[model samples]
Each structure stands twice: as structure tokens, then as C-alpha cells.
Target chain A: MSLAELQRMTRGRGEPRVKQETPDNKAALAFLGPWLVGVVALTIGPMAASLYLAFTDYNLLEDPRWVGLANFTRMLGDERLHKSLEVTFTYVLFGVPGQLIVALGLAVLLDRGMRGLTFYRSAFYLPSLLGSSVAIAVLWRLIFGGTGLFNSLLGAIGIPSSTSWIADPDTALATIVLLHVWTFGSPMVIFLAGLRQIPREYYEAASTDGAGPWKQFRSITLPLLTPIIFFNLVLAVINSFQAFTQAFVVSGGRGGPSDSTLFYTLYLYQEGFGAFRMGYASALAWLLVVIIGAFTLINFWASRYWVHYDD
Target chain B: MRLTTSSARRTAAAAASIVVLAGLTACGTGSAPGAGSDGAAPELSEEEVTLRATWWGGDSRHPLTQKAIDAFEEKYPNIDVVGEFADWGGYWDKLATQTAGGNAPDIMQMDELYLASYADRGALYDLERTAQLDTSGLDPKVLDLGRSEGTLYGMPISTTAFGILANQDLLDELGLELPDTSTWTWEDLSDFATEVSEKSGGEVVGISALNNGYSLQLWARQHGEALFSDGSVSISPETLAAYFQQALDWTASGAAAPASHQAEMAGVGLDQTDFSTGKQALAFSQITQIPAYEAATGGATLEPVKIPSEDANEAKYSYLKPGMYWSVSSTSEHPAEAALFVDFMVNDPEVGGILGTDRGIPSNGAVRDSILDGLAPGEKSAADFVAAEEAYIGEAPEITPNGASELDTLIARYLQDVLFESQTPQEAAEAFIAELDGSIQSANQ
Candidate 1:
């Protein structure tokens, strides 16, 4: 019944009636209560605290003291901080593009009907599953060590190796970036899923129009896959920026060979936990949040120019 | 939609149960304080209290320590102890956070590198003020090691001395006799290592380059210098240069593993594949580390030989280092009970025997004597070596600054650059001094 009619029925015209609550509304409230509690307790609460800590000087052993903007000011002058920022930028710059291109290429290759396609797709997805593991990082370290299997293989080909690829200051970051790029399977899987969503009739129409595979991909696949590609790009960039465990494990948590592979999160780790500079680390963390947020915003803005949507 | 609703209900129910259980546990009157009939009994109340303790160790250590904690709980049925163990890579970070959060455990195992920092910051409890402490049985010397600014911050659980663990089988295979620990200098040891590497056709490395700062400190102490002053680095530039040069020479001749490999083994304890499989001929470790080394090689017949000194009186610089210490938190609600438990853990015969040589020979002299008869053969030899080297041991210093641990990392990194990057000792030294100054200064502030 209409609210006005109900009010008129319940009370004389022009006199408001108070509606009583029902069991269903109470049940709905009960159901939504836990979710509201979790959102506040787990997510928003810590976020607010961390933001406050960002402005303080809190060593883990001592109570946090208010020190307005000092941690941020110190970071601005910290050489190691600058170096970490540079390293993180280099990683994101190279890793995101490399991963996206390779993922798309593989997705297109797997889009065609082929024998044992299921096995191939599963095989391609394995690295993404195992790539972030400690065992893989350890394996990566051994493979890139001076006397490692990689060097042994190189020796068989008569290449005299004098240095460890991962331990060399000049090459360590490159090696990690390569590891990041190699774990392109997840994005490839996502791209493949998006590819399947594009109807086969569109491709057939392009074929009838005498467009070759390149022309067809440029016009149809590229435009349709734009959204997915953007998604992968944003994810890869963020993950690359936050990369820690690999560098921590490989460098023995020192971020060494002269801090060549000192990713930003690794530096933040050393600051917060290593040196007990939780306050400074909190500032760094918020700065990272801002950075990732800005990049996401930029990607979303850029998407409007190129990304196509059917809906 | 119906299934989703049902599942949501299930999740809510589960969550509610968890919350209820947690609240009940939090407010439970399980550990209510009580007075004994005599009101003077030193025994803790039968009321139950659960506490969390954390430490870092290898997989083997995890089980051993867990068993020890089980034993601790069994003896004190009223106390439920939870153990949080992890590997060395991130141990300090975890402990630091727990302490900083002001929710630190009633008991924690810490390293010397960090003990001083924690103590100085008043994060640890002073045992002397505990109502039930009976430290009268503690060895004067062992107790002295934990004293900082006239207050005890830790009780020694084990004493360790760094020495070279030689593979006797490898020496016999090389047709070489054991180097005399009393006469061998650093140069002599370096020569011997080079000879072994050459003879093995580089199939085996002579020595593994672990103990980055210990080696440098050993050398500097031999020359009558120190790494730090009242709270700052006091080592001379020339000493550091010579130390780096020697380390580099060893690496150049393949006496030690390459810098990269050594860095990989930095915080890994003694369980690396090479050490475990007897791939390396010699490795450097502390006395307490013998069990790990021996177990790794599966009793391959090894001996702990003194690390070579640099001069005639170089032994003066070498000393028995404390492996680890047990301390109660300053914020503990039951300091008296904590101290009594600590004393029992280290001083009582039954507890000491059961915990036999796990942490190393108990630092308490009486407990050490009691456990001597039951030590494993390997542990006996290790204890004997440390005891024999006691006369040459240097004075144990007070707690170090919090910045000291970070300096250790800085030192290790610069050492890597010196060995692997074709950087000169002079170059590394200057960079190291600068970096050390920066970190130490920051810490001082």
C-alpha cells in the first residue's frame, strides 16, 4: 500500500501514524551488522591509525611522539630513500609493459583452437601460482649466483662469467624485473577469459572484409581487450612497487649489493621493523598508498581515451 | 540466493562463537591470585595463565624448542605457554613489533645485538625487583654478563665461542695434519685454506665466509681496538682496511666462498645445503652451533679448532660469546613468578637436565656442573673448548645500542661490495665509515 494511504488508514487525515518495525527489517539489520562492524574494525580503523602514526616519531620500543612532518622531511633528504624510489620506478616502468605485452601475445596465441589447449593454458598458469613463493625466490637466487646453475650452463658454452647476476649492483634490479615479467601467467589467463567473451562472429566479419590477423587485432581485439589490458597494467604496476619477499630473501633482507634492488617496500620494512622506526615507516606507507592511488586514477583517466565497452 | 543466505548465517554464527569464546577467555577468572595456606609459599598459584613466547630458529630447532615449551607447561600445569617461532630472516622485526605494541610476551628470547637496545629503552624488566627471585645460586661471571648499568637485563642460557669446525675426513683425505690452534696466525690459516682449495681442484671450498663482523671484530680486538665506544664506532680506519684486505685475499684465492654465496648464508644459521652435505671443508660457528653443524653432516666426525689469531697475543682478543639469554619483560604482571621460573629453568638440576644443552651449557656454574655428566658427546667437546678458551676471553661489555644491529647490516653490505664489486678496501672503508656515522648518529638522536 502507498505510504500516504497507509497513514490515512492508520490515523485520521492530516494526522501522522507511526509505523511499527517488522521482523524482516530486524533480520536484515542483523545480517548487515557484522559486515558493517568488519568494515570499520578491520579496514577503516587501522587505516585511520596508520595515517595518524605517519605524523609521529614512533620507535616500536617507545611510545609514539608527535613530530609534525619530520619523518617526511627526513625522507626527502635520505639518499637511500631516493635510491629506493628510483629502483621502484625502474621496476614498474619495465615490468608492467613487459608483462602486459607478453600476456596479450600469449592470450592471442592460445585464442586459436589447438591440440592440448587445456594442458598448455594450465602449464602457462603454473608460474603465477608458484612465482611469489619463498622456494621460488631461493631458486631464483641460486640460479643467479656466481657459481650457480646459470653460470655452469654459461660455462658449457665457453662464456667466462666473473660475477653473480643477482648480486651485481648493476644487474640485480634487472634480474628481479625479469622475475616479475616471467610471472605473466595470471594476466594472460585474464586476457584469455576476456578474449573468449568477444563473440566469434565479429572476427568472422573481419575475415570476410579481407582484414588480416594484424588488422583485425588492431581494430577489434585491441579495442575490446583494452579494458582488460588496463586492468592488468594497473595490477602489475602496483604489485611491482610493493615487491618485498623476493628482494628480502635474495638479499638476506639487506637490500644489498649496495642497495641496487632496494625496492620501496623493502626500504619501508627496514625502516619500520628493522630499525624500529614505525612512525617513519607509517609515513612511507601512506606515501605508497597515495602513489598507488594516483597511478590508479591516471590509468582510469587514460582508459576513457582508448578503452572500448559494448555496454 | 537461498544458499548464499544460509551460508552467510553460518559465517555469522561461526564468528559469533569465536567472539564469545574470545570474550570468555579474556574475562575468565582462571588466573585469580591466591595466597597459600602459609602465605609464604614461593610456589605460584594453581590458577591457569596463558602467555605467548616467540623465537627464531631452523626447522629442527622449532621442534626442539616446542618440546621444551611443552615440558615447561607440563611442570607448571597452571601456565599455558604458546610458542611463536620463525626463521632468522625476519625474527628481529617480529620481536621489535611485539615489544613496541606494549603487548610483548611475558618471556622472549633475544640476541645480544638487540638486548642492549631493548634494555636501555626500559622495555625489559629488572629481575632484582621481582618478589620471588632467588639468584643467589647464579654464577657471578654468568650473571655479570647480563648486568647493564647495575641492573640485570638477561640471564645467560648458553655461552658460545666462534671457532673453525674442520672436517677431519677431509683433512685426512688431503694428507694434512690439523693446524695447531695455539700457534696459527690469521695468515697461517689463510695459507692453509688456500692449499686445501688448490688441492681439491676447486671441487671443495676451503672455508665458508660467514661471521662477517665477528671476523673483523676479532682482528680489531687483537690489535687492542674496539668496534664501538661509549655508544659510537671507535674502530680505526687502518684496522678496518687491513681486515677487509685479508677477507678479500681469502676470497680471491678461493679460501672462502664467493661474496654472493656467503651473503646468502648470512642469517641462515648452519643448515645450508653445503654445510649439511659436507661440501665445505671448514665452517666458522659458535660453540652452541656445533649441534647444528654436526647434525647437518650427520656426525661426519668434526672438531672445533680455535679461529687463528693475528698476533702473538691475539688470543687475548678472542673470547667466549654468549649465544643467547633469557629475560623477563619489565612490564610483566608477575615478575616474581617470572624470575622464579627463570631460575628454575637455568639453576634447578631436574629442569636443567631435561633442557640439557639445548641452549648450550647452562650459564649457571652449578647447573653446568650438574648437566656435564649427561651432555651429548658433541656438546661435551664444545663445552670443553669454550672452558679452555675462557682465560683468553675478553671482558664482556654492557648492552649495545639499538643502532648496532643496523650497523651490522651496513658492515655486511660494504663487505659484499669489497669482495664482489672490484671495490678496494679503502673505498669500502670510507663508504662504511660514512654510512655507520649516519646510522649511528640517527640512532643517537
Candidate 2:
């Protein structure tokens, strides 16, 4: 419409409302345009394609052939898939909680006024920065290798040690879990932020009532911090389930030492790229989505009992 | 508020229009020049063509490969070749992804184990039909190694033989004589290695256990079985069990490094290996690796010997393996140009001299003979070892069966099980055969 007509419409009371509708819709569409394109092209498009491919047989080089639910049925008999799932679940079970405990403990210690607090915070946070990196994984291999630093340290203390921690199936997953726990900086920072937001009045009131420090923390700190803890817990669980690079690099990308370190994502990578079983990999991917979705849904459902939001 | 809303709408409209215009321009400029031109050799038409070439290797090989690509570009001014290289570990995954996306390099370096898988899936161009690549200079036997079902899908760049790599210095230090490799059985190997361990006061083992699937295949071949034949696992469980048992015995008797130590060396390369670092007297190696092992040991003389066999006359353990292959991608826009580059890599004496046994002995007989004098002492020894074993070199095993690539991980796991005493040799063997059979059967389906 012309500028004069638009102005005249705005001047009119009831008729102006009708004229405003088209331009308002256009403006909203313009605001949403880029994000809509991205969601459709990058996210939704791939998800749809993979959902279709989950039922097919694809080796990447050739066209995917329809096999209905054969890929899913094949997973029933796949021992490696079972092993990978077990390893992944174990990692998440221990690693997420262990990491959160370390992160929160350090965050609490740092919350107490101390000298060189920034330096300590940075130092504590450094491992997380380097945690998922390939270089750190390689360093992990050297430190845990037979005749390496760990064994050498043991020998210096008059204990004879010959085990390669990363190479032994029994200890390989544990070593990776240790690496996971070392990278608590991100969640620790989140917890620090959460602690800072808690008003000092509540703790003071608890103290005035002759409450012990532990009692004050238990009554005042934890309840107020439950929401943040819930948030961190969900994030940690999701991140742990998707852990790949550290296991990939440390295990030499084959998830070996008898598949002890075969995280779920690592196995999916092997099937998709290493073995060219892209169809099976797509099926695995969808299954992961379902698994993660179910876990998150359960966490939210259970949060009603524990997570307390002040607002 | 009404004025603000109308003005905001106008601003949004203007912003959206700009974005749409920018996107349109981007789409227009992104189209390649003359991308849809009709059937004519682009190289001959004075149209510039860019072809990507990818390979996996160590630090030394990358620069040499880049230099060769530069030389090719220099020779063919109309053709530009982009070189992609990585360490061996991540190369296959990258190549597989690129191939799946239908954007693989015009020329790719292939391994014998995965050559059949790629060729069978129609990811490789048939070299027999590519006229620009001359195969006449290559030995027919060497050339045939890259063929799948009589179709030439890969061009052999070099040849290597699997054998025992022994540190002569360590053996001499122990005052141990090298076993007669020509007729040595597995028992002889064990006894000799045990003697070395004893004499050295346990400072070194006699050998590192041969646990790789390729090594196991050699053992199976010596027993008149192929690892895979006719699209299935052909090695009997008895043979597989025997192979695992020998490894178990070696680890048990100090003929090989301790089980834990062997496990540590699983992902290590030539530089940090026990044999290369003088921690072990002997290890399994391809003849091509002799130079690397020699270099890693600070010039210690490393010698290649025949792999041990049970029967002297029936010892079919040693065979010439293709060091690597050069194959053209099926999706290459400029196949003729890629073929020319492959021809240069295979037949050019200068390229051979520059690469100089780094990729094993050259597959082309002419290039092989020309580069002999230029080879290092260690490389020369490897070449001599290959020549000496020509008479005993058995028939090359069937091009590795589809899905057989997974056998390496399976064998390593089973071998680890036996070494760690988690499972008996028979149990590991039974599991291994069942797993391998399943993999092959799935691939066939």
C-alpha cells in the first residue's frame, strides 16, 4: 500500500486494524526467517533423512536399500552394541555424579573468601578447557601407559606396578571416568554462580537460631541450590552419554582393549565411518535420541521431589 | 505505540529484502563456470581443472607426496591437483565420509584390505579402462594384486612382504645367532626367543607376539587355509585355535613380551615399539617398515626374516603384499587427468627416486630397478629380502573379503583374551570364528 493510504488507515479506528495485519505478519516472518531456515535445513532435514535411512541397508558407497526394521533386529544379536551400551551407561552412572560432586565441592571451597581466588578458579577450570581435546587424551595415554608416569610413581614409592591402566580392560573405563571427573570446571563455574545468587540473610538467620554450619548448609544452601544442581545433573548426564573424542583417541578409535572403553557414540562412529554401516549407524543414532529423550523426561518427572525453585 | 509498530514493520521489510537479495547473489555466484559443459576432455580444451588427491602416511611421506603433486602440476599446466594427506589413523574415516558424500578425491591412495570393499561397492573407477594410466611397466603379478574379480580397480604403487623384523644389535649383545629363517618352525622361533630372554637376563624378550589379523592370516596360509575365501571365513576353528595357542604360548614362555606390555604397544607406531626401541629382540613387520625401524633404533641393523612355519616344504607364509595402491574415484570429473597423475606416480623414475622405497619397492619393474642404487642401506636390505624370498612367496590370498576389515579388531580382542588368560585359546577361537562368520555373512547380505 502507498504511504498516504497507510497513514490514512492508521488514522481510521477500526479499519486500520485490518490494514496492519499483512505488514505485521511480514515483520514476524522476517524476524523468524534465518532461524527457520537453519532449523529446516540443518536439523529437521537430517533428522527426517536419518529416520528413513534407519530402516535401510547403506554402506555409504551405494544407494541405501530398504530393509524395513532389519537394522533394529540386527541390534538384538549384536554383542558389541550391547557391550558399548553397558560401558556407556556405566560411564554415565558413575561419571556424571562423580563430576558433579567434585565440581560442587570445589565451587563451595572457592565460594569461601580466599587469596588468589581467580588464579585458583582458573587453575581448577583448566582441565575442563582441555578435557575433550585430542591432545589431552594422548597425554592421558602416556600417563597411564605401562612403564609410564603412574607406574614410575608407584615404583618410586616401593610398590611394583606393571599394569597399563588404559590398556587393561578392567581399568580402562575407570581411567576414562577419572578423566571425566577431572573436567568439572564448567559445572563448577555454574555452581559458583548459583552460590553467589543465594542471599546471605538466610544463612545468617540459620546461624542466629544456633544452627551448626552443616545444619545451615543442609537447610539453607542445598534447598536453594537444588534447581541449579538439577540443571547441572541433566547437562552432565547428556554430555557423558555423548562422550566420544577422549575414548576415540585413547582407545585408538577402535574401542579396543576388548571394547571396555567402547562408549556408545564411539561405536556409532565405528559403524558409520569405519565399517561403512551408515544405515545401522543411523538406526543407532535414532535409538540414542530416544534413550536420551526418555532419560531427560524421567529426570524432569523425578525433579518434582527434589528440585526446589525459590520463585 | 501504533506508530512504533508500523515503523518497525517497515524496517523489518527492508531488512528482509536485503537478506533475500544477498542470498540470491550468493546462489548465483556459487555456480561453477562451465560446470555443465558438454562431453569433451576439459584438460585438452584449455579449461582449468582441479583434482583432489588424498593419501595417509607419516611426516616424511606428506612432503614427498606434495612435491610429486607439484611436479605433476608443473608438467600439466592445465590441471591443478590439490593434495590431502593425514596420518594413517584418521585417513580411512575421512576418505569414507568424502566418498559417501559423493565428493571423494579424484585420486586416492588405497590399502589392499579395503580395496575390494570400495571396488565392489562401485566407488572406484576401473583402471583397465583408463587409457591414460600405463600399466605395462608394472609386473602383472603386482598389478593383479589390486584387481577385484579381474577388474583393475586400483594400480599397485609398490610391493612389500610380511616377515620377522629382528634387532641384530640386541641379538649380538646376547650372543645369540639368528635362526635359519628359511626352514624355521614356530617351535624353533619359541626356543630361539626363549634363549635370547634367558641370555639377556630378561632385559629383552625373544620376540613380540604376532597378534595382528594379517599375521594370523600368514599363519593360516602356512596351514593351507585362507583367512577368507569365496565370501566367507575359510580358516577352520582348529587352525584359528592353533594360531591363538601359539601366541598364548609365546606370551607364556617369554618368547614374546609380557601380555601387558604387548597391549601397551597395540596402538604404538614404529618409533615407540618394543623391538624398535631395543626392548625386544624381534617383532613382526612388513619388509617396507625395515627402514623406519632401523631409523628408530638409532642405526641399529634391523633384518627381515621369513615368518615361522610348521612344515618346511609347505611353508606358504610369505607373500608379496601391495604396499599401497593408487585408484581413481568413480565420481571424478576429470578421470583422464587423474589417470595421468596415477601414471606419473607409478612410472616416473624421478618420482620413484624421490619416494625411494618409502612406499616399499616400486611396483613398476623399471622404476624398481632404477631406484635400487639410490636406496638407503636398510631399504636395500628390505629389497634384497623380497628378492631372496621370491621362490618361497606363496600365492597372494584372495583380495580381502567384504566386511573382512572388522577381522583385525576381532583378532586383536581374541588375542588379548588369550594373552590375558581371560579365555582359553579354544574359547577365543570359537568366538572369533563365529564373529567373523557373522560379519562376512552380513556383508554378503
lDDT of 1 by residue, B1-445 (tens): 3445576667655655555344233321213232112333334555777766677766656776676667777777877777787766567767776665556677777677777777766677776665566666755655676766667788777777778888887878887776777768877888888888888887677886543556566666877887766777777888887777877888888887777666555535456656566667877777666777788788877888888766655447775555677777766665556666676666777777667777776777788888888788789898898888876777654345556667667777777778775568888887777777666566557
DockQ, model 2, C-alpha based: 0.30
Report lDDT per candidate.
Answer: 0.74, 0.83
User: Which candidate gets the maximum lDDT versus the true structure?
Assistant: 2
Q: Name the weakest run of 10 consecutive residues (lDDT summed) in model 1 chain B.
A: B27-36
Q: What is the DockQ of each candidate?
A: 0.25, 0.30
lDDT of 2 by residue, A127-224 (tens): 99999999999999999998779999999999989899999889999999999999999999999999999999988888899999889778888899
lDDT of 2 by residue, B318-378 (tens): 6787889999887777877888999999999988877888788998989999988878888
Clashing pairs in 1: A60-B100, B124-B330, B125-B330
Off by over 4 Å in 2: A1-20, B1-47, B313-317
**Candidate 1 — number of clashing residue pairs?**
3
Question: lDDT tens string, model 1, A251-296?
Answer: 7677877788888999999888777677889999999999999998
TM-score of 1: 0.86
DockQ of 1: 0.25
